[model samples]
Target: MSTRTDTTSQAGARAPGQREPTAPGFERLDAEYVLPLRWSEYRTGDVLELTDYLVRIAPNLDVTVVDGSPDDIFAAHHQLWADLVRHVKPDGEATANGKVAGVMTGIRLARHRAVILADDDVRYDRPSLERMVAELHDADLVRPQNYFTELPWHARWDTARSLINRAVASDYPGTMGINRDLVLELGGYDGDVLFENLELMRTIQAAHGRERRVDDLFVGRVPPRAAHFGRQRVRQAYDDFAQPARLVLELSLLPLLAWSIRRPLRLAGVAALAAALAEVGRRRAGGSRVFPATSALWAPAWLLERAVCVWVAVGSRMLGGAKYGDARLKTAAHSVPALRRKLTRADGRPGRGRRSTTSRPR
Candidate 1:
């Protein structure tokens, strides 16, 4: 093994304990790798320490923690792409480095067929990287399901508001290994690569003409840096949970409008009134005959709850914006392109490949 770093080598080499054996006249499937970063709340000087920790823990995974100010780095060393994020800026903008930044770097240096865009805050255990890499044989993309590591009180409140976001993910169909070509083929977040999970799923679904797949490739638990009550304290932007709105819109409104003429409001109204009258009559009869005791009281509560649910459904149908996020980045979907250019500039670009020698170890 040799001790050197460069764009090509850093991105392409295996970790300390890992071996990079290639058949004669054939290059290994390993591609260039990168971790885009722009720390917020966490101190700047702590970055090197963080990278050092990563190297120590998984030296096989070469990481460069690039600083936003100093553009200079060893051309041979693994590059750590960096950017500046401010509290004043929107949350999404502040953390927009990984998608475009890391993706772009991988595109530049990787010898492997695939380039992975990973997050810095995520903790990858010993088997994690290998598993994700292995997934490439079947699919183009591999998005690991992430568990919450830390959180704030407000964040917990936000999470609780959404009914569908309780678990790591909803009970959907088969695991999808989203192909990279599917994403690139679709031009992936063309205007803004600062995408959330749902956006990624939608993109995959759109390109492949099928929903995104799920798998158990990467299983990450809460790291020590994460909060003890991580699930409750974690706060995500409103835009991150896009499913709620889409689900509500599709389930509530589109069907109503499409079928309005056939059923008609008048017909629905008459049916509802009839149902209500029937319900009241049954309750009255049960109060006097069947239950004769609890029905006089329990029936009212049951009816009220049912009525409220129906009312909410009607309103949800009328309103388009039904889903909510802990924090919302209320910008036009159209505004992504303009924002993407700015983020790409902030992330900067990687240089050409560099070569370095490793120790001639057995």
Candidate 2:
């Protein structure tokens, strides 16, 4: 094993530990790879500086970068993209990096067995990548764990959210490894989705397919800047429309948390219970220790922040349309008073018959 990171792409870029199908512990089919990255000008310098390293890890990788920036910025990376050994660019546009672009890129690799959808900045090595590929054997899509090992205060605060996510076996939204034909057959991701990976995961699950969230397969992600956290948090909460149950649970928890604040003893007891649940959920999901156990103590604070964001997001959506970069997060669909389907008539009347009727005041 080498301690050094290779920053160049070559024909024979080595994938150590990516084993043969018959190799012990390697049950998945060894298939060719295609990667799609969504790019913009703001992160161009940082992302391109590391793409070479990405190619070294997947030398045979068919990497395509879909740019959402201007023509000039595209030109800047054009030569570099040309020089890179493992990138494929057939069509280009600024679709804001959602299902549309993802499908476009995935379409190019439809002939291949697998398509790896990723952000422009995510760089992973062979071992982690192999684990991800292996994990894909069990399901239609696999979401690898991407986290920051060492975190500052802002990231640790964010960590509480991640720990709770494990309770639902929620996939990390930054990257996806999906079977190509399945992606095509499933009609790709939902259009106009802000959280593309999250939407895709749920879409696959909704279709009666299994989605695996791989905890053993991990990748390092640069912690987001502190200033961006609140805006990003709000935007993410807004996208919780894709998972209504989660939104409902999060929304419902807020009132209880607030009420408990007036009673110190109750709040402590609730916090203690939440902390224990968080710990158990994390371990069960095979989550990393990136989220400190002590951080779970802030579950109330996390829930309150999310509740505020959800309200603001709902209000913004109702009042006016939201632009992607704007700090006021909004979704096209109104999330407040979430619409849940119960067995009932289309005319808003309760249905007749024992199976369809509801039981009340029995």
Candidate 3:
């Protein structure tokens, strides 16, 4: 890890009173391939626990925490983690989506070719972390599956969403492993998009980079507080705007429900079909082992919620955009063709626009 300190008066620079990072007691593992772990967060609640986690993984991987918290919180984090991991702030000119700025900065600073990016809540065990890093050698990106740990009611409710996603396709996880060179090659993805993950994935696809989605590679994630989960309903729905087909399907749901209201049997059949689909998703990719069976039963309810929230998300769009932290972002994600044009123009080469291939674990 680089010990060079930022001398510029930038947000990520060490505060005057902040202590310099100390050499910790743990010994680095003698592994042929070790990746850096980049964790991004604006404000974190579980500071101590997360520090402990960083300590546990310190020997196996280089870790960096790109924090964008207030001065007091930043100082506190530096105090706790400076000795254990690289703790820094987001760059002063971060994108509208601050997390992306942190991600970009972390990747730029990583010592390894491959790096793992994660949210504050995502927790990786040794085996899963190593597997993701190893898999990245064959593909440009690796997306692992996330399941909630210590499920609350809201957690259970959200698990239904994951199950449905898994049934139709792979679920979008909080953490991903990517080859640093690929992102740098593309000049970093657009940071203003609402669905940042999808934006990154699409950007890779636009550049004809290979992606791997490990459906059975389960990583534990802490569920958001109930109140936080409640606030995310419409915002989460707004992400579907990135996928026109899915957005169209969600937008038609309410009207379909109203049309079927007069026919009880039709409504029952629709609900059953939703549940059945969720069940199939629950069983796919060894999900039955990690996800609860009852979560599949919540599919109809979750779909109903999306049916209503999607309209609200549309309304927000018409009014300008949805609130993300302090910024209101309208665009969910750019189309692949648009990104391909942008990339081609950037490099002065005809973009191949090759379709991305997914490598699933057998």
Leading candidate by TM-score: 3
**Per-residue lDDT for 82-166 in model 2, tens only?**
5553444435353543435645665555445566666644656556667666666655677776666457777777777767766
TM-score of every candidate relative to the true structure: 0.43, 0.72, 0.87
Q: For each candidate, how many residue pairs have backbone atoms clashing (under 3 Å)?
A: 28, 0, 1
Backbone clashes in model 3, listed as residue pairs: 167-281
- Cα-lDDT of candidate 1: 0.35
Q: Please, what are the lDDT tens digits per residue for candidate 3 over residues 1-362?
A: 11223222221233332222223563443222222223334333355456556655665677877777767667766766677668877764768887788888887777777788888788777777678877887788888899998788889889999988998888988888887888887888999988888898888888888889899999999898899899999999999988899999999999999998899998988899889999999999899999987888888889899999999999999988889877799999998888988998887753344557888875
Winner on TM-score (2 vs 3) = 3
Clashes of 3: 1
Best by lDDT: 3
Any runs in candidate 2 off by more than 4 Å, and if so which? 1-45, 85-99, 206-210, 288-291, 320-322, 325-362
Task: Determine which window of 10 residues in candidate 2 has minimal summed lDDT.
Answer: 353-362
Query: What is the Cα-based lDDT of residue 239 in candidate 1?
Result: 31
